[model samples]
Target chain A: MITSISLPKVEKKNDPSLAKFIFRSIRDAWDYRWAIETFVTNNLCRRYRRSALGFYWGLLGPLMTMITLSVVFSMIFHIDIKSFTVYIFTGLLPWSLISDSAIEGSQCFVSAESYLKKLFIPKLFFPFVIVGTYTVNFLFSLTSLLLIGMVLGFQWKLSLLLLPAVIAVTATLILGMTILLGVATVYFRDLSHILGVTLPGFFYTIPIIYPAESIPEQFRQWFLLNPFYYVIDLYRQVIFKGQSPPIQDWAVSIALACCLLLAGLVVLKRNEQDMIYRM
Target chain B: MSAEIQIDDATVRFRIYRNPSPALKEMAINLFTRRSSGEVLEYYALKNLSLTIHGGERVGIIGLNGAGKTTLLKMIVGIYPAFRGHVHVGGRVTPLIEVGTGFDLEMSGRQNIYLNGTLLAHSRQEMMEREKQIIEFSGLGEHIDTPIKYYSSGMLGRLAFSIATMIEPEILLVDEIFSTGDALFVDKAAERMLSLFDRSQIVVLVSHNMNHIEEFCNRVIVLHHGEIVNDGPPAEMIDFYHTHIAGRGSNASTEDRSPMNTDFSVASPSTAVSVQEQSRFSMTSSLSE
Candidate 1:
């Protein structure tokens, strides 16, 4: 008979498997869910504390942006004021989630420097917090979009029930990109500035204000190759156009989201332990 | 039943780089050049350190600044991974390595307790349950609801200390925390720490103060240049670190060496110098023998 009398241990291994690394990091993200929720709550509370309107600001802020963009672009770009406003808000809100996550999420490790030096909080927790904050903001902007769309006589569709699916796909894609960019940002601090400069150019790549039909027939397929274009297109189909997205659009979005999510997790898993020293 | 620490030839190396962060221009150039550009200086913060502290032992780590005392503590707590060798720590570790972090300054002291507690792997319910204890121990009273930024540095220290010691951990890793807080609070903190010392299976204290180490620790380890120099009873180990490792440039024979430079400066000026010399002579003679 074998009798074992040993205690628990924390051992350092020269070689760590990426599968285990990712699994553990992901587990910690759930394990510390309270911290992430608390951070996001504190952040939103602080942001709205000074403003008199409080939670309405979450709604009216996007409405104001939509009104501003619709007026300027309607005349300049020769688009209809009503449909155009609805269209811009739909694309802009989702894109902001992506762009903001890419920009701020990159600094997840750098910004959390104060905390990282103190405890053993998982590296993924901050990235999740960043995602969580943006996700909440996205929901607010979405509510604002729906309210404004109804007032502007934009039609609602049976596909509206599927909005959660679109948001999930978009969020998964954004989260994956943000984690990858955030990890890379720790190694390359300059990536943050690069994101700032290129994000505007990336915005135009999606057909938010411009009509999708405007692209030349020869170049249309290549234009569709932009994976984010598919996500925005899906949003446009469901909310802006009041129709279900094409099955092909759903396939592209889900496939890209899955690929990006796996790659991001794999990258983070491989480099998570080594990151503490770099900071 | 108790925490055990085993570090076998553990080594940690840190790389210092000139312009370590890859600039946009450097990356753009490197894309075509096929070469790396940053100048890196690699050095070991810990070198082949083999140590085993059994359960129920209070170990004091005494060393001069830059002797890798903090690095060793971090390695044991699983912050910095060992570049070479193995480190196995049994049971939960609570590291007070660097305080005044893991908190949002804009958040109130009450909120910070939950934030920091969650960072220590405690659930929200656990923090909520301990909130009263943390507030009582911190002695912040009515000020607990105020933003942490409004609290004085000492008040923040109390809050940090209270949150860290809210529950008894199996292994408590402290780094010179006794230096903070006022006289009354330090005594209170010391009393709290001693109680923790009673409950913890292993307590590792890294302090520059010789008196605290001598009074509290059953065993002491002397560190010099990222390696363990000596390990034994607290009095002798502190004595070893104070004499041989403290004054690095001067030989033990140099009579003019300042005794005030080391922590063993409580004696009279003449006696301090002679005591240091005698301690130095005994260190060398013991090695020779």
Candidate 2:
């Protein structure tokens, strides 16, 4: 004789689990704010401690690169100087900001493995500090860009009001990418290698040197799909064209930034514990 | 405040993946056959171990290497998670897992004091209040301004110990970090440990040194291969440990002795004397003794 076996059914609850998780992440970050601030300040001071140039080095690298690039592209390629210098500077500023943030953010946790293993501080701050420092570096370059624009006889206009909005968009986009790449770098270290190769290619593809109109009609839609294009286009519109970004472009970029931010937060929350083992 | 640190059936398990390296051909084959042995390895670092530690109790944890002593301490301090059971730590935990683990070698000692103190959860104002006391205890005087990389291991250990012990945490979790300094520093450290016990109710010390275990801890827990074999007063536990070691030594010698001499009397006297000496030394070394 055989008896039928019955397993107990588990009850499923309908709840906003993600909201709870995000709330916990925010709480954890709040608890570890002191540790994060100390870590960042210490790291920043340590990097410049032995340097002869001190923080002047921050301004030096971008200025040298810009001068070299402007000479080669403007003089040799016979590029138009009327708005091209400001255009290139604007694009380069944000691109470098993103690239520097991405590279440093990806290595943050891996380098802090010793601290992470011994303490239970929030891991999000590693990427936050990396991006925060690079943003400071980017701000220095932005000042130089403004100075160069004035030197090139470009008129400053009210479209500069759109500058804050553009910065918000750039920060949002970088924050999302930083968090995502920071967590992913712990797992697939190969992602860092892939990013190193792809980032430069990405810059060239985004029309930092040329206008979007230069793209063939057949390829225009394909070009618009690249997120960096929208970011760089907004920079050119404000600084060179003296016009604010279109409502449609602003809406699309904001939505994309929000999506990436939320997605990155989700990934970071899920992998918070696993990060210890991976790193 | 109650000084008891209670752990009830706490278990910590880790899941690790074991993936076979798949060549291009293997990947293609697996796409169809799906016969690869992709498995997960589950390891229990600490099994269902429970302990109750009361105020003024210095408990020592003894085990062979990799017997989960460090894991247990880390869990108590909430550095690692427990897979099952409850841990109720009554007060602030200061874990001195390693001397100078968090010290930045490039930073000056004064700067590192702020950094280290902040990481240990002290506010700037709080650390500032204790600044004079910490420096005095460290005994580094003029060297406090120098980069920590210039400091010797003993100097680093002293700085770390002074900073850590200065916080006056309710519960202190110490690993085998006290062996870094010279005899003078060791005496200073011992004095500091005794002072910490005046304020800290529970002190969990993990060390391989039997003398340290017997001296500092009133009660001892014997762990072997991830399980607690005995938990009792230090005297009985030390005796059990010595007898167990002696039995293993005698058994090993009996197997390889001369062909004609099958008697086990040769391994008895010396083993007995060594065991007695060890126990006597442990008793005298005990803080209560």
Candidate 3:
């Protein structure tokens, strides 16, 4: 049965250049796009599988959070109830998208050990699924915000057309962060725990519960330190204030998105082959 | 395109860290200390292993646990990276490494087919087209609509095997697929497995059942301590395995030697007779040991 067949000797291949690595990673992700879709849909369904409210739970969770924050902050801070509700709604939705992506993304690769061990799935796939799932939920809650704002006589602005762009940019930023944190958590195992403790602390810095204008003048520079502030402010500008965000806001968020994505991809390319052994 | 696998002195090394995942504080503390952090132990799963498998070949891998049979399949599947050398596979590989490799148990059987298909690189549209055929082949009937968590192990195996063999893969790598379905389902699975072996350009099957290996495979490779100890026809390799490997202080008993022994009912009479002869040969060899 053993035939002495002489096949041509294959040459040793060089490691893929960083640019080629990134390109191949993108190609692999594209090839598995349907898998990502299935994962995202599967995640969404399982989230509310037994819940009576089903898909509405995605909307109600954030809506309830916004309402509770609006009432308490209005009473304590003496802010206008109507405008504050809209303000918190805009701020809270994007914040949850970011936080959910980070916290859950940290666990994405770990949670997917079974799949990763058995197949040759790209490392980017799980992070995309994480970002994709939260992004869908974010869009659901965003829709509810728009309908509720119209009901409350919040003026509809032409700037609302810009919501998708802002959401896309924000989702990209979340994707980058999720990938970085997810891969990091796979190695350190404690970074996920650290993220849980520190991420809520970041919420206060971003001015989600309070108005950005309320920050004292001297501490204003510090708001720029939190990357979420730029993104959340972009959402607030379009959804709550009915105006296009300043060029600096767009520039900052977009830059953060690119930087995080590049960092994530580089880290992923470096360790992807070895991650399974660690897991 | 012809399917071929060429592995040139490939080595797979795993680092067994003392603290596989150290906390941030421990890392920070270690950075300041004179002592190196946690000790690292490097283990080679596959060392300088080289083999070539061409199209139109059914290769069977046999070895003890931790002998790197699955590890080699994984390296060929591109799951485990070759640490030192290169592994070149000329075509797309479809691996049946385990039952339900990417299954979402919370999902219904129908949904799982789509999920598994996509994981195997099939598009949603492709899955939609093939979903009915897969369901029909599995014969789950109305139960396809219910969550797969309710599926018995046998039912899960049927669905997994059906989805995996939905299309003729260029290279089919099987690592002891656990298909413990009813006798009827097993018969169907056996037929499918034989057909898959026929259609796939290259099939690498890893199993302990020498009967299956002798009956199905033309060639066999024996692995020991991550190295190829022998490679030859199934008859020669099976005799080598029974006399030298399995018969010497190995825990494999006559019954333990053949996990697919039950499938003899469906096998050809001559094939079943050969299996009996193989078992008798193993028994005599073990007695001499």
Candidate 4:
């Protein structure tokens, strides 16, 4: 007689528990640091497995680029070589780091679609791996640049102590941009193609090959608007000019990097679950 | 006492995007055309469903293709979020969703063992200690030093299965994973899974193979249209599954009702009764089996 006809209704809450959930996810991501490192290492080593040189190929690209740049701008252009090699090398070092990181970051999630779909691991680590692997390549190029600088008789400046601070700021800026572009590239596949064309043009505008002073006085302030200008200028000040970067430049660069990083984190957190749908 | 694993009214929905006519003119016209401003179409992959899996319980999920069985397993593993409810898993969950998921094809198997083990939450030192055992279980011998790209699909599956089950996770989630390898490896893998079940508190397996479900799981749940149509002992649930398939005009004929034999050397005793039932339903083999 007591045949159950009705089932109990489950109550639904209007408010979503988004904040606590995101916080917990970030904490979980931070706890998986070892897995992130292994992923990066595996990706880097996987690219050149069939090559006889293995990882030595990491040095090939930057070395060739540095040699080509030094030859064209210094030799053909008849630019002064007194301290120009050191200056150009310094600028190229950070430029390659930012450019390679950006290029790799833009393609990061798109390339790892299989792994991303299959695993619940943190997505933020994908871009980190891109930047981290390129950082290793950048350091390899940096070592060669330092040797060239030394051979060309450039003296070590006391301001070189600020090198670590400069590197930290550059890394922070690159990290922020990488995260933004990486996530955006997932939705707009054309973003990578746009980056491919824009990077070379943008490189000339940055004072990598030429100093900011080379631009006319009327355009000096406009050149400062480029973030890479400040980045290249920081390296120039420490390695070439033998003086510390002004406090304002450091403050502004750090602020810009942190702002970009915060914005990227917000976008990533909001889109994390929906990312699979987009992919 | 520890809390048991509970799936509280979980639902999963998928949005299927349909492209407009492929003609350029049609695509351009559709781009300019607007109908409902905010309407979007979606398909329910898994409807609201609840199940309580207690400690020391082995439950098998069986369903036809696209029945949301894999979606349920992914939800339990935390890879997919439920649209409506929460999956409160009580302990560490190892999802054997796909073989070689995290393996680096360019990395040597020996190196990948450490990498894959770390992703499974094992420390470097822990992987180091278990390195020999993992290699031996994989049976790759000296070939373990070669990059995984050279491995056949079976070898890769064996290696992945070995590394995954090596860890003592509290819960194991397997999704048709045993059907990957050769007969010998399958037997070995099944034995490993059985041993793991003895130690783990909960095991949830999703497979369309009724024999596997009946052999490994005490309880089986049959899903249809993302809803649980049957939930009970494996024998009854499997019968319901076969009936549902037969009703759908499946080609499971009485002549096709071969005995459930893993090795095919001897017929399983249960298969004899199943074959007898199939003969009675042969006319409706297109209806009821």
True contacts kept of each: 0.40, 0.23, 0.53, 0.20
lDDT of 4 by residue, A1-279 (tens): 011222223234332455665577567767666676787677677767688988877676566676677767777779766477788888878887888788878888777665665556667767677767777667778777766667667797899888878878877788778879888887677778778889988999888777777899998888888877777778888888899888987888788878877777777766565566545
Q: What ranges in model 3 sit over 4 Å off?
A: A1-13, A71-78, B24-35, B250-289
Q: Residue A271 error for model 2, in Å?
A: 2.7
Using all chains and alpha carbons, the TM-scores for the candidates as numbered come to 0.86, 0.80, 0.88, 0.84
Model 1 lDDT per residue over B1-289, tens place: 7679999998886655445577888878977997655545455678899999989899999765556787788898777878789999999888876654556667788988987788777889999899998899889999998987787767877888888888877898988777456898889988998898888888999887778899889999998767898999998887777678765544433422423223221121123345435433433332332
Q: Name the regions of candidate 4 deviating beyond 4 angstroms.
A: A1-26, A47-54, B1-3, B19-41, B244-248, B251-289
Per-residue C-alpha lDDT of model 1 across residues A5-94, encoded as one tens digit per residue: 222122346666767776777897888898888888776777787678987787788878877777898889797778888877778778
What DockQ does each candidate score versus the true complex, computed on alpha carbons? Answer: 0.29, 0.24, 0.37, 0.22
Candidate 2 chain A weakest ten by summed lDDT: A1-10
Error of 2 at A80 (Å): 4.6
Local error of candidate 2 at residue B1 (angstroms): 5.3
Instruction: Please give the lDDT score at residue B201 for candidate 3.
Output: 95
Per-residue CA lDDT of model 4 for B1-289, tens digit only, reads 4436798888775543332113344445656894222222355667888999988788999865556776788777766667677778888887776545667666789988888787766777888899999999989899999987788767877888788778786887877666547898878888988888777778888875678899999889888767888899999888887877534644445323332211111111223344324322321221222
Is model 2 an incorrect, acceptable, medium or high docking prediction?
Answer: acceptable
Candidate 3 residue lDDT tens string, B27-111: 7897788445656555667879999999999999997655678789889988888877889999989887754566777788898
RMSD of each: 9.2, 10.3, 8.0, 8.5
Error of 1 at A142 (Å): 0.3
* Candidate topping DockQ: 3
In TM-score terms, candidate 4 sits at 0.84
lDDT (CA) per prediction: 0.77, 0.70, 0.80, 0.71
Model 2: how large is the Cα RMSD against the reference? 10.3
The candidate with the higher lDDT, 2 or 4, is: 4
**Cα displacement (Å) at residue B77, model 2:** 2.9
